[model samples]
Target: MRADTVEPPARPSAQAPATSVPVPARIAAHGASAADRVAVTGPDTTLTYGELDDRADRLAAALQAAGARPGSCVAVLLPRSARYVLAAAAVMKAGAAYLPLDPATPADRVEYILGDAATAVVLTDHERAGTLPAGPWTVIDLDEPRSLVPAPQTPADPHIGPDSLAYVIYTSGSTGRPKGVEITHANLANLVDWHNAAFEVSSDDRASQVAGLGFDAAVWEIWPPLAAGAALHVADEGTHRSPQLLQDWLVEKQITIGFAPTLLAEQLIAAQWPAHTALRTLLTGAERLNRRPLAGLPFTLVNNYGPTECTVVATSGEVGPEGNHPGPPSIGRPIPGTLALLLDEAQRPVGEGEPGELVLAGPHVGRGYRHDPERTAERFVTVRTGDGETVRAYRTGDRVRRLDDGRLIFLGRLDDQVKVRGYRIEPAEITSWLTQAPGVGAGTVTVLGDESGEGERELVAYVVASGDQPPAAAEVRAFLAAQLPDYMVPAHVVTLDALPMTPNGKLDRAALPRPAVVAEPAASPAGESTDDVKVWLGELIAELLNLGQVGEDDNIFLLGGHSMLAMQVVSRVRQRYGVKMTLRQLFRGPTVSAIAAEVAQQQQEASA
Candidate 1:
């Protein structure tokens, strides 16, 4: 992993995955990393820097032989494993861009991405191979030895330049489909450089990978540590899903650097951080961070803000300690080399007190959305700089006002799109799904509840029935649950006679009615012994959400309990019961009565 700047081997000979001092990763020459350090680690697997470099070299030679080259898109559908890292590195080594696809996504979505990106090859495990839609892609199964058997035992570091595409990450589109953002190697390198400098990344640091492959944040997770000669601990699916398990995993791995989405970060911050926790830095982004960081945290928490168009991060701020925060912390200034412009609706610079669109211009900004020339032209525009040089910039839809102190304060989105639990989502996408559902005619999804120092802001779907009876709320909920992620699914689907509209025929957002609370009450646990525990849990949950009362049978999330509130529950339960209640258990059984049962089980086991 040591930066061996000596001219790279024209064709670095590949042995089977093996590493010694001087790892010599293909990216290592350009990336200041150490060779002997552990490059990637999973729950059961670890790949040394040298091994990772060699394996990627071997695989890159194979990919080049199989008709892949620079500018080609190679999709990887493997889960979070050593192979996932190997495949991504291999693609880059082959001078081709890596297209990461979540195997958990619906097949149709996967198919769309493959075709849209013109994927040249697919590197996946046997479990996911059978499901890939047939295409021009040369499918290779990681489980099968034959996939790598024919590869030339050498590395092919093709002529890769900064402008060459590095990866294409798809984000939710306003038009009901996802748009792929094309990022180049230069963009990646710039981000890696900024990350290393900002965090003081080093070979001694152990970073954790929690973001899924399909996410852009995964780029930050995979690259910086490897480039900085650090060990990257891959969080298993369970650990990534369960805040309780993720915290424990970080401690067990002695992770020093970690990144999580806004929702999960809140829970991790609020949790009972073990005294031995080794995490020193935590990076969180992707949604609004409302909670003031708590005191006594061992790590420095940085709230980052960025659009996928601008690599992974744009601005970052280390939140102040408890009780000293002036307000919701600002997004801070731009990173080194990036320029943030606050322009008003007229394209003129806005005053410090005025809100304007945050336009970003830098080497880190992505090449623009793939295959969508119109959108690319609209979003990524060329502007004359103060130095009289022309540079491309991305128009971020986020509205922000600059403070007199030079920091930027984030105002809510200026469009219909909203971020729910760290996922950038379009209400139109949900409405599109709803309008397609049986018995639903016109549908509109809007955010409800005040988020600023108030209740949880949640999505509400208002629908007009196509048939005599409006679609059953449960039926609509089930329909969405089948096709979309949990975050995209509306908590309540309200049926109305007709959607309220303005004189101009647009939906009047302010006139949307509140969701009628029609959820059938869950049966309360009716035993005498557990009543006290249930009552206590109920009070704790009620206090967290500021509800009048939380029934023993009620689901917290249904009653507007988001990840932030859920963490408060976990924290409060631990303080009261001296029991470590997990986020997984809460998700499994959110009701107070059910949690009381889990607490009892954990206690009995601990005693045993």
Candidate 2:
């Protein structure tokens, strides 16, 4: 870490006033001042500050009685609801860190996290409690009326400290499982304080909680506004997924502050909104943003960047409308109390405007990964700056380039950088340009090995089109070839209506459909029609599934076809013959012959 040459934006500021109040304490203060104000709104519940504070107090007392204390971990396994917010506030009030568990988490993964964190109590609703794996831990159903009782409003805990664990979030690990990241109250307070100030959060503002319950962004979504006496609106499932629905919901609810992941944010910003819409700020993170907002977007579009190890957000900057700026939007400068250093593999600072691994240091840094000292040591290390001072920092595995103005432009993952024919490539760089290509709504590039060549890999591009007609694969390839080097251009392109995303909103690379194979069809047996629709479909199926051959009676799914691949096939058939096909029809008759017959019937009806 070279601090002497580092700019002010990358240096930890000692002059910044500390905003390290425990989150529960801050919320209680807000409750005292704004007791009648709306604090949380959900499908079936609307909580005033007084009611929310009282319920949290009651739950805190129950948790304390159920063996939760300052060092204990309490797991919250509820869906996104007002009760989930109450449970989080209560857990912290009880002087215990809450381990947020997504309701959709696999039972085994839930069991593993519960065991790994040594959770003393589980706070979940009745509907989700039955899904929890049996373990030697207390399970308190939040839906059970008898489980809560009134307690003191302040609900102060002498054991709570700035260094006390606030939350333990589990991020996907490189070892094919999950690892828990331990964040402290100080770390969380820094984020809440920065967010509240940066976004001008106030009691008059209604913030929306749309991120998955277990995502670290949920912490940012919950605490900052609530602490500032703002109302929290829990978006319904449909609103959470559909950008159009979310836009309407935000306008209808008069939500002033909202957050969406990168891809969703791209679509949301491009949409038309009323001139008098109440939304003033739209925040996005959790992935590299590739699109700019449309010219007339009335709100400030802020792009944030951070890892779970650094308490949700490290850098933030407002994104200007398209054409106002060139290239993808920057992640912005480091937030207050945080330091961002761009360092090379040799642990030295990279030259200005050069790419390097972003290493972060300061109060925002978390305690480290839970129960994995070895992995923790590998990622979190003490480094000596040029000033001869040693500081502990978390190494974010992301590759980024710093602009002259000190903002960070995300390049891609350092580990994700692949060498193709001796040339190192950043897929995100290609994607940034790919998304801007004609008729391409969004795209991601990945590397796959050649089927015929040993140890040879080529680029593969998967795109979702902006128009009804997907661009031809050859057209996309040619477009990239014009803008990029020959090696950087993808060898093949696959178009889909939408990209598959994981439950947490990140792109699911593992679920991406493989490129369709090309092969010459074999001759049909004597007397068989060469242009038979069934025979044609069999060939399409074989190529799509990369099968040696597909028989007429063979089921598509049985031959490794999935919903996404089936969608591609259906899209192809519609484009080729203009026949309407639905997923239900595909599932009803999964065999090639059955689908061919359905298509033929549709064609015959059209002709008649």
Candidate 3:
């Protein structure tokens, strides 16, 4: 079913009831009282609540001194560091909306966001300060001596309303450009309050910050802790790759609360939990939470669901061995102070057991998009129920069924939205880039190849060669490099003579061919010189391809070595030989001996 094209139920009400809150005081109150508590922990540094608040105050004062007006957009480009959190808080404190520009984002994309938002000021560290596109805006570097100057104390502004824009998050737009979703301070405050009350976050709780600063998940990673006087431990980029290191850090830091998507949680589960960790709450969201990942984790496992436009989260459910039931756990019930309804195409409430689009209504709803009024009107609409009451509800493009017990069961997305690395992706956007390459024709992409217990889905693309010319997979990848980000690009591209069609004549994605397997080479029968290297490559490829007798000349891609498998191969290669091999190297040299030789050469050069 086409999700975005599916017409939603008509609005029940002509107008939505106004639900807004005061913004500045909420943050100030939390900051003032918990200033001395630990707020953020990074690789080798820790910022107490007091330190964070002070830094934010200084930054806000600087912005205000530079003539930044309330509601103005303040763009931030930085890594996942403590400064990013402080800068966001500072933007809110200054009564300006924060726009997080992810460092990993392409320069052109970042320029588009800054221009669209008409950013008044930008706060970045020295490393990324010069990377921003040329613009007429004040730039403040946190590392500079001038940035350390403390401005006069600006009292908390009580005038900032809940409906005021707190931040703007840009989603991967299917139409080739990113669209910004404007979230208000009131919306964030409501979400934080809901989480604090529901999860019972206390001053003693320590939450882990794993998601990137640019995503909505970061809100959950940052605010709940500050609001509840709890601590937040920021995981470094390297920690995300090493499950063992992450597990050790989680235990050593005594993190009581953290959230990861089911994929990462499954990885942790597979690696086995460390003996010393004391995790009280393990919240999973941004994707479906399967049962296997939560099977033996000694903590409360919460499966959460919500869109970026609806604050951090709107619904959550607890999962455990005793309560384990069925395929995927229910999304549970609406969060406190939130209303969830299942409605059919007619905007009528669906009866129990009937499938419908899930609609969310509450104060946690964001302030709509930044500059796209038409797009905003299309997604966010007011719906009236049978009771003749009006509420502003976000039409979540999710297909769901109301369970007999009132819980909502996730069916699937009603649109092209797919989760990759816990970030929502629109396949159309990725396909647009793929089709731009020379010799490329109609391209249809779908996420297939999910591990038995892992919730992560691997993206695979099926393309019909244009006319008589078909572009090589490598060339297509090179073409995509300039047009799209790494995550959006398909890991595997399969050329098809013609796509299979359903009875209705729609493309039948299930009939696509899986990549052919190629045998990796066995060790030379002549000598012991290459024994250990051959043995290692054989074991790695065997585990990846689920086969033995891998020939030396066997191509990795032909053996079904996609990006994820390539990463696994690289990690194992690095661990065994103490040498690094890039993803490109693996693609170029798909054989054991070739890759081993390349690594050996690099090691020799380093030693020289």
Candidate 4:
């Protein structure tokens, strides 16, 4: 179960020659070969290589015709679908930088990103086009099937150099605004080449697109396969939710390579794979990888580490059973073209076994954040190494140590930035909102997750109530919804009698409650209608709350069931019985028995 590191593989010979074209051209060149295959699979349909290329070419032509000039920032807002991928390809092909907009992002946030980036146009499907904010921006609908009228082949614009910007990915900003990271063609190409070469990828290899297009991980998922002439399988939202479906899709499509955050990987492990699975290499990054779930997987698991400033990844290590013994496996050595240095606050190299900030320098380093010179210069700086080489290193803000074996062991962030479900969450922003909630006393919130040196952890909130009566979980959640996004909300809320403090009276995060997992019991014996409903409702509530048990009168939201989970319970209730109820109705009733009575009443009304 241990990975053996042999000497680095021989690089491609001078005669073999690497492709010098930008990423879009490289993809086009690969797609030109009829034999080259790129299949994007979704919940309902799949597109072949020819179809994908044709669609992208058509969209690119359309973009050009629609006045999208070179270097223009074209915002893209679409769900995880083929259209999203094709639109991205189109934007690149049109010689414009694609700005990704996450569907789950708030409308105001989307507006801020678009305005901040000064996007010239937006390419989205019919489903999401209307959701865009009202502006003087040009929008292209890719969902509408247009005739693939071959446009005049515009000669490859040689002016677009490798150093030119390719895309701008916006990360959640700590200061109430989002910051866009400008990634260059060279940066992306280097990462794609490194990943493909490191994994020995081939045209036969198939990879999964699990992360959303907005996430930096999606860059790894998309470009690597296309650059290597391999296949990229796109999984829809539902497919991503069900681990079994993901495994089945991977097996059915013969996926040989894939990447996901540690959170999604843990879900795959919890779902329990079949006796056999066909994953050759599973890459996890953007967050720390837990060792427990990765132990028995029948694939070579690699832990990739890097910030968005370092393109996709700077360092990667193979996870194995032997390496799992000493806490967790190392973050592995730097990739071939990358140099990882552990530097102190003064930017001096820290000794081996001493913790310091991780700094990265290489071809994969991205250009500083778009249009934010002050913040950009703060993090990205030039430093002279002990070897007397001056290189631009990105201060990752990740605390780490160089182990005796030359691998880096990640400790945690020096800042308040924490990773949840693979996305970085700034505690300052979350706490800013939590402290403002009415009835909540001066509150200091801390994020706890599996990456926090424990098992898979969700967000848990420990609040100090203002008065004798504490606000309900529903009210707190409602307040959070107005300020924070869904993923940033704490999954569990513990109304602490008082906030725990450290020896010096600082907020103690370690004392927070770990998310409790509730298991479902075996089905009960056939019984009276009311008793049967009570047992079923109790089990449902327990599962919803992630609690060991639930009483008939226990309030659902009070036990940590959020609005989303309330809807899920309602859906499950409808599926079990031929009855339907709305989330509002569930909130009003607020109890399992109450919901059951509503369902029973609805069923009776329908029958009558």
Candidate 5:
């Protein structure tokens, strides 16, 4: 049998377990032995091990008095801070799963999540208490002095077992609403154990917490280090946005370990660093990595791959320095205690090195989506192993191919497949090739209708320039034509200063601007082409802004054009004129006449 084609490992016995210690219990043990050590370092405050334990214990008692139980779900709505970690630990100590809610979440969405989870208690700061929608749950403001009234000095020890619910994280649902995923203590414990052992986390290490409160990466960032008795430094909002600022902060804090989303990590590894630094390991996931770090890097760059359904990570490998390989590094083999299988549509194992759906079975798998039995039944199923043992598994809709050494390379999502002109295309493959083009920093591809609503889809590419001069549309197309089929080349290539991203650091596809209509009436006379372009662009702007008509010299911004709308206008101009138009040009001019003059000049320069 081929090495990569080996059958899945034997199913774990029901009586055996992956981890013997729960997360809360580990934190308590650390508090006893390292009471004076700093547990959390926030922007404005610091908490010692004793203080964190006592405060969380007091909060847990209050929650219990407020009628929280072993199976109840508590809601935590606070910004990233020392209190945020305290609240999560308190909920687990009270024997209730904590549901994270970002304060910035829309009020209606927050209301829906609270109602759906049947949350009985909500933990937040006093300043943000009024922001919450009126709900049936009891609110406890951690900032209020009365809320922490004297309680037992020791930690609260409720009956929290491996089977007890740990946390319920909500993920974006396909139906435009969010679904809560229930993770048990066993699942969380396995992650904590694996993280601590894999990363060599210890009390002397200082880790950074950069993910938001609602993202699943935040859970992974918070618990692993704290449970191991290390100090977790909370990064400010600005540090997370700029790669240079983040690297400076990491150096200033002397952080030994850090985690960033895939996009940010790609930028961070490419940025310059000091000759010697405290950082030893950098972990990144939540998207496919497109580039490898250059040689002579100080730290080990580890690329990880997994869905929220299977804890924070299932496969991980250290990415070596950039090499002559044609593609990015492979997501390493499955972690211990986890079994991964690649199966086709018929549930049969695919041949070696063939792409198939990634199915995971083990203790790391989440219990299932909360209040979504149908979806749970569909995604999480029982599969019989080659040895005839049955194990519950989650069918990750992601496609992957196994390497000879058992490493997996992430293909695009099964649902994200696009069909253009009777040919199936994976946009990720195109994006990867675009990023490899000269003078291109990053890129993404999207599919949109032809604007006639006839259901004809075309691929639109957006790229960021690595230097002052952006790659011309013709040059980019020629480059892609060499690496890809003719049909796979994008119909429109729009260059931008940067790609739009969510607060959690994932690509925001819905936020991508749509390409403009390419069909325009030609000039009536040969000498009137520039005037014709101005008139047509003015009319297009008016139509997009929902105005009856716009004057040639009117400023679009003053006429209610926002950043998103500006991007749309730029996309239209780039496609129509075949020029490398950017948002800066629109912001500088902000009028139809000014943009038309610049466009005409660029066209003249191109001809010259």
Candidate 6:
């Protein structure tokens, strides 16, 4: 530990104000008070406060008639459009908490979540409603002609209280099943108050909603701006992953407040920000903040840390442009109305400078997992603080050390869970699926190697065959693709006769061997292309993948392409062709031929 690693004694206090109002009430206040303000802005449409409020009111009446009651779970599973915002507000207007499901999620995962959540009604557009897996619930297409008109009569307030259920977000669980963290209106109010007060959001501020609805950060992205009477701009599809495109978008929109995952923030920090950039504040969390003390940025760079169980943000710190810290940067101190306690295995506070499991308790804490009493009891505990006051808190499985000065430094995880691209993944989730696959008796999955070496985190799996011959690594990957999302598919799959175990019968994680490269089926050659652009782009993509051959139509993501790889491809395109391609363009046109065609069109337009 360095000498300057002192705790921040003056960290923000967690004394939240007493509030009897729900989050919707706050929004309703804004709607009445700031009716002309831009409430929600997206690429295709925009909603003013009055417009959003009226639509929500009309839709709420229809929802109540359709049997949506208070405390019911109404799922909003639409694309990031104006309809998405309307559906969310309308669900709350109907006196029910809304569950947001990202349309990009795999069908299997969506099915599991809808069933587990006991969703009362799923609100989606006409195009997407048919795509949803048939479930034993009502699927209302919000785009239907009848839904365009709100029901007659102004619906009375459902009397949503501070203690009522607000939202239920699903997160990775240690036991292979996904757990839903039930956040109450009071928890949201605590976060909204702290954020609005801390950031000083006003009508001049334009906040960006870059996070997908499925992410807990979306909770923060949506509420704070609306509550502060600020404009909330929703980024279009394929904008979240690519840092360069997202940075350009932020600058173009003149957004004052924005939130991104840690990786993208690091990229933006490294980028050459425009001198007159309107972006004022960049808030990042969801993963560890590796690149600290950003250099030469005309914005307030805030590193926030929290889990789904504790609203969105528990601790947040703003680093200066100097980016110079005495030691390894920490996740910062507790946010307002939140407490961070470091305890040993016995739940006793550790000595100064010692590391222990982190426990978070405060007004921002949620109401624990939905319908999971056993898990709720285990993780959410009532404990006595050092001041001899008993309070309810959530036991975060993260390890951290409290500095002598008062701040807390994050160490690492105390469990097998890992975060990849800001998504919390349980190794057990992968191992459980591996064991169920045919010809597999038992299996183990590990996040292999250091994250830096692999460009990104790689989920590696080792499975012992139940038959005479072990299955091929490629074979297992294909099996997993149908059931798992693209991200959950292992980067490398290895076959083993048996796994090494210790004398005590516990599997020794250190003994697991490094995974070898898995052989994939050979791709057919790209036909003799006289077009130089096509040939150049194909070779560039092949070089990036280290593959022997890449067809013009080969999908980059399907062929093991990641965000880092995608960035490299874009960089090469800019270097060779002078065509500025967006990440969304790459996502839409993932093949070498498709990219070359896009580049060719740009050249044609330039010449014309």
User: What TM-score would every model get versus the actual structure?
Assistant: 0.70, 0.83, 0.70, 0.70, 0.82, 0.75
Misplaced by over 4 Å in model 5 are: 1-18, 150-156, 450-456, 467-469, 515-608
lDDT of 1 by residue, 325-354 (tens): 545556666776778888877766777579
lDDT of 5: 0.81
Question: What CA root-mean-square deviation does each model show from the true structure?
Answer: 14.4, 6.9, 13.3, 12.1, 7.4, 11.9
Task: Tell me the deviation in Å of residue 165 in model 6.
Answer: 0.5
Model 3: per-residue lDDT, tens digit, 1-608? 32322221211111222334333454456568866677788874788877877777777888887656677899888777787888888888888888887776778988888888888998888888877788978888877967646566653452567667788888767688988888887787777766776677888898898775666787787877777777888887645433445677788889998876544553354345755668877776765443434356666667778888898788776654423354445667677667888888888998767888988898778878788899888889999966889988899888787655556667776765777776678665566456556566555667765534267677777664554344577787778777777887777876543344322122445555555422123333322245566667877787778886687777777776644566557645654555656544665577888876776676678779
lDDT of 1: 0.73
Which is better, 5 or 6, measured by TM-score? Answer: 5
Summarize candidate 5's per-residue lDDT along 137-161 as a digit string, tens digits. 9888877878656545444467888
lDDT order, best first, reads 2, 5, 6, 1, 4, 3
For candidate 6, the lDDT comes to 0.75
Residues 1-109 of candidate 2 have per-residue lDDT tens digits of: 4332222233211234467898888888878888899999998699999898888888898888888888789999988889889999999999999999988688889
Looking at candidate 6, the ten consecutive residues that score lowest on lDDT are 517-526
Best by TM-score: 2
Give the distance in Å from residue 132's predicted Cα in candidate 5 to where it truly belongs.
Answer: 1.6
**Candidate 5 TM-score, C-alpha based:** 0.82
Task: Pick the winner on TM-score between candidates 4 and 6.
Answer: 6
Q: On residues 125-210, what C-alpha lDDT tens digit does candidate 6 reach at each position?
A: 87788888887767788778586355554556778888888888887678877888898888888888777777778878999988
Model 4 alpha-carbon miss at residue 302, Å: 0.4
**Better by lDDT, candidate 5 or 3:** 5
Report the Cα lDDT for candidate 3.
Answer: 0.69
In candidate 2, the residue pairs with backbone N, CA or C atoms under 3 Å apart (3 or more residues apart, or in different chains) clash, namely none
The residue-by-residue lDDT of candidate 4 on 1-608, one tens digit each, is: 22333212222111212344577776666767843365566654666777767667767777776666776789988877767777788888777888988776778989989988888888877778888887767877666655234344442342568877789998868797989999888888787777777788888887888876677888888887877777778876534533345677777766788875664453454344555577877777755553434356667667778788888788887765533344545677787778888899999988767989998898878889888999999888998888999999798888887765567777777875778777787665565567557676544556664676556657766554555455666788789888788998877665543343322112345554443421123444433376678788898779767799998888887786653465456645654564545544675688878987886687678768
**Residue clash pairs of candidate 3:** 3-414, 21-162, 35-50, 519-551, 520-550, 520-551, 521-550, 521-551, 521-552
